[model samples]
Target: MNMRRNDVNDLQVKVIPSTINPSSAELKCQSSCRLPDRSSFIWYKNGQKIQDETSSTYEGNFSPADSSSCALKGFEHHPAPSVCVHGQSCNRVIYTDRSICASRGSSVDISCTYSSDESITSSFWFSPDRSHQWQNPSQPEDLSKDSQYAGRVQLLETEKGRSTLRISDLRESDSAQYHFTFKTQSFEWRSSLPGTTLTVTALQVQVIPITVHQSHMEAELKCLSSCSPAGRISYVWFKNGQKMMKEETSLYSGQFNPGDNISCALKGHEDYRSPSVYAPKLPSVSVSPSAEIIEGSSVNLTCSSDANPAANYTWYKENEDSPKASGQIFTITDVRPEHSGNYYCEAQNKIGSHNSTLHLIVVTDPGTAITIAAGVTAAVLLLIIILSVFLWMRKKRASNQSSEAEERPDNRERTQPEQDNLHYASVQFSNNQADPLYSNIRSDQLHRHMEEQEVIEYAAVNFNRAGTAPRTRGQETGEDPSALYSTVNKTL
Candidate 1:
């Protein structure tokens, strides 16, 4: 019958030296393939299975000529690659822990254990750039000699088999794999396969809060670090610099007051506490002219609130979704009636927000009414001036007519006759033609009488002897003697 080959291709065993002792070492074994249930491994030395050495690894003192391999217990015919120990006895370096993490701006200690059989000359840590060859071919490189880690790097502890490297003000650029190299009296050795890896990080705080009511009176808070800290972590919470809560967990639940400042930090990192945020207070609004507001007048409004961080202000009017204005002081120039409404101001900060409302009552200016009254008064004065001018012109015209009538030429001629001593009968004529005196005169007789009178006006009359009247024949002709006679009286 043909035998099946065991598929234990990745089974391997190796020896790791301890830094404390150069000659002592520990054996470790692993396999890439999963082993069958209840399966065990066996160890081999120099192509020979040791009797009753059924484990995969063996830890004991061994010479450099010894070679070790591993295989499954049932599949002894198939074995892994043999690993042989190399290098001189006294020229080896080892490290204790190969990884470390530190906070930025803080200090960290990188420590390791090493061993040397020969007299040691020097030892140091370095990061090798494989792409570039060392400038000095004979000397081991040191990171402290580089300009990058000059003052920040220091050797804290150095001894025969142990050393520590301390770096202050750790920066993110400091994150790299570092190796430990040592020079002996005759040989130099560097541990390059596994080096100490460093991680530099910064600490930050994040706060989460939950509110149950409108005013944020009752709430819950959680203080969390930006990165989860290794090992056990404890939290400390503060309110206005007074310690409020200390717990292993990062959560706190309590009621908050207006303007209460809250912050939190990790127990060890108290100097980098979270920024304190205060609860928002109700905002107060005031108008410049506290009395009645008037249209077409200037007005100023101010909003204020108490908060840890100064609040941002926004102004709003009733029935408007967007803000009408923004700032601590809101100004309205030449305020109009439309500006009258329920105005509100919101003051907000990172923690919370609040608002205050004020009713603006814009009234019509009394000066408007005064302007109208002045205009009416001016019109009435103008009308009185026009009426007075009309009345004066009428009186002046009547006086001029009377003066013209008195200065007529006919009146002057009549007065001159009076000065000549002429006797004349005064006649008064009525405007009515129906009177008996005027009606009895015929048109032809009146015209002849006027002609005869004109001729006898200045005729001289002689009286007979004594004052006897002269009779004329005109009396028998039916003409009145008085009508024919002319009387001319002269002063003696």
Candidate 2:
């Protein structure tokens, strides 16, 4: 008789007890049983009834009306007890679905479980917020719920005990809460947990940087992340996957403001160590734009060496020491022809150094003064030629005039009467030709004859031009013509 009472109590709580802990037992019973209306199921212990029993099964102190007892007559196991599961919202016979958003084109799962020990034969779902009721909705529903979830709603292929609903071809309209209804052999009830809600969102992607332009004076390197409610996050810089010692930028020309771009140096080991986070270490260097220089002019060189901590700059002359030229302009005020050579600048930092060479070719042309000198030389040579020609012609004319003057004789005049010769006889003969020194002749007559002959040969005076006359024609009858001519020639 006592044993029968224990057996009856065992039948009241139907779940099999786990051997691991006999005290802790699960309540497993039909999830769809109906109770006698107005007369609730009573829990009995030792042939006595208990009211409002909450335990799933009795492990110790069996007695009716004991709060520790797990016995209820005419009522199977149900999950509506107020002690709610952690992280869950409510503890009710039916729970509202909460898991909403899902990826597009993917299957959406709506999970539900009825908190009752009654055997669930079938389960159905209804589109909440839409005025529609389901009569055996698992089979077919009214046009309102049917038309809305028509091609997208269906029962899952799992066993009915799982009571899970899966909807395919989910669109944006299917994002509302759903109601799940459970059916058993004796009664029907909704799930204590609400149907799972689904919110389909577009597939989100990340924004990544590809390449940065070198010409940019200042630029940022960005690693775009999926747009989430959480704004911009922090970034970690890396070099060859090694985390950088520092995080901020100092040498960069631009600031790395929130969501803004970043810049870094690139003059190290000839390689780049990409950053781990979304932001990349933009290994960049500030390079001065190429400049123009006159062949003979000088200019100072300037360049920037890219680096994380920023690099120092050094000026050089073809890899030589930088001259003490102020500023970046290597000015040579009095630049000479020999002050020409190759020039360049170097920028350096703790990481490394960068250098570029610029060939300085000084330009020049012949000066105006030199050109003027050459022109003067040619003009003077031409003038000398003209003067030499003129002088030569003048000298030739003067020589001819002097020669004519020497060849011509001066004019002379002779005016006297002529006389007849007196008569005289004297004869002498010598057998031998006597020397003219021993011979004695008329001295005056001999001398006169010689003079006459000389005058006739030498005289050709321009008497017409001088206004004079011939002396020989003027001799008288008493004088010999030879003697008179001789005397006139000798006297003239």
Candidate 3:
């Protein structure tokens, strides 16, 4: 049976007696693994077999073109990768990863590998100052001794040609180019050319306005960081605490309502999430008295909406283009009939805007209304007065007739002998001679007696036409009617 050597383990070579001076530098190759006593070794330089001597070590003078590695005699297929010394001191340092990005308040590790022809005594990592050189330090200063990196920086590991520097609680000031340095017995070395660059950043969300209408608004949101992160990165979207279906894209677009909260983050970096942004929603309008909107009354209309940032309010009429009022509460003092119409309010924010509608109705004032009522009442009163007067006149006439009937004698009384009828009878009276009855009477008494005699004659004629008994000359002579007739004839 054949036995296979453990070729998978790494192999290293170092120079003995150090290369301090190029002119007298003698390089000897030695391996880290232990071989059997007196075992022979194979040596190669830059992938070409240079010696196959039956010794465990190779000795030669250092040369600028020489790079060396070794393997067990028969296991040459697993020879170590090449290593070379460039400077006279044969001291060199290198970083495997040249650049890195880390979130603020996070931890990071910078790895490097270095080699030297002499034994390493010290190793540390540092950032250069404005002079592009290492700052002043104490005799044995390392990264942990620096005031700026005191407790936050540490050397995690160090092996032959390998070192790792760890930094925690990263801040933006930590972003800079870093170089690794180490000291051997006689030489100090620092990595040259490209060094590890760190970028410390915090996530931020940017909201871009697209379009806005009365009902809704459209906007685009993007996840942003200070510098691009290393490796594959994915984005996550959230709305009102709920995860959204959209992923893998930095740009997001949708209609937003007022008070809607939106946020984004990297899939693996939820701790450094962007701040929440609130989108504007449509407005709602309400009136003090929703129904029976009246004119000539004080009224108030309120507009409200939810949004990330507080919203501005503007009130407008149906036909007007310019806003009539501005604020959450729109007030109309002493409203008029013309104020009754369709009205709407606009609520706006940086992200979006919306509008709501309301209707108003105005009525007549109390003073004018009372005037109309008084006019109607006066017309009714005037009609009542006129009707009352007409009724009073008709009643007065009836009363006068009743009084006349009571004063006049009935037909039976007229026909009785106690009542005497006076009539104006024609009697011959010469101007030269007066009657004896008139000769004794005064002129005033004669005039009054003639008036009385005429009224009696009218009464007798009315009675005679009303079917009462008429008196003959003989019957009237018995009651002295001849005397009254003679007296009336004398007056005529």
Best by lDDT: 3
RMSD of candidates 1 onward, in order: 28.0, 34.0, 30.4
Q: lDDT by residue for model 1 over 464-487, one digit each (tens)? A: 233344333343367653453332
**Which parts of model 1 have CA positions greater than 4 angstroms off?**
1-94, 105-107, 127-160, 168-173, 190-194, 217-269, 273-492
Per residue, candidate 3 scores C-alpha lDDT tens digits across 1-492 of 232444312445665544566533333444454545665667765335667864656666656534556665665544444456334334455456656888665678898777667688877877754223335432323566677787898786756678888998777788887777777776665332335778888766687878876656688888777767666667888888888975667778888765578878777555556677775477888998654545657889999987655788999999989999999999988888899899999887767677889888665766565666678889999999999999999999999999888867775576554236454332333234332223233356655765754444321111122345455443445756556555455454
Error of 2 at 442 (Å): 99
lDDT of 2 by residue, 146-187 (tens): 766667666764643444566765555666666665556755
| Model 3 misplaced stretches (Cα beyond 4 Å) | 1-89, 97-99, 105-108, 129-141, 144-159, 190-194, 208-215, 218-220, 234-255, 279-350, 353-492
Per-residue lDDT for 150 in model 2? Answer: 67
Q: Assess the local accuracy of residue 301 in candidate 3 as a C-alpha lDDT between 0 and 100.
A: 96
Worst 10 residues of 2 by lDDT: 411-420
Off by over 4 Å in 2: 1-100, 114-122, 132-145, 191-193, 214-492
| Global local distance difference test of model 1 | 0.64
The alpha-carbon deviation from the true structure for residue 40 of candidate 1, after best TM-score superposition, in angstroms, is 26
Better of 2 and 3 by TM-score: 3
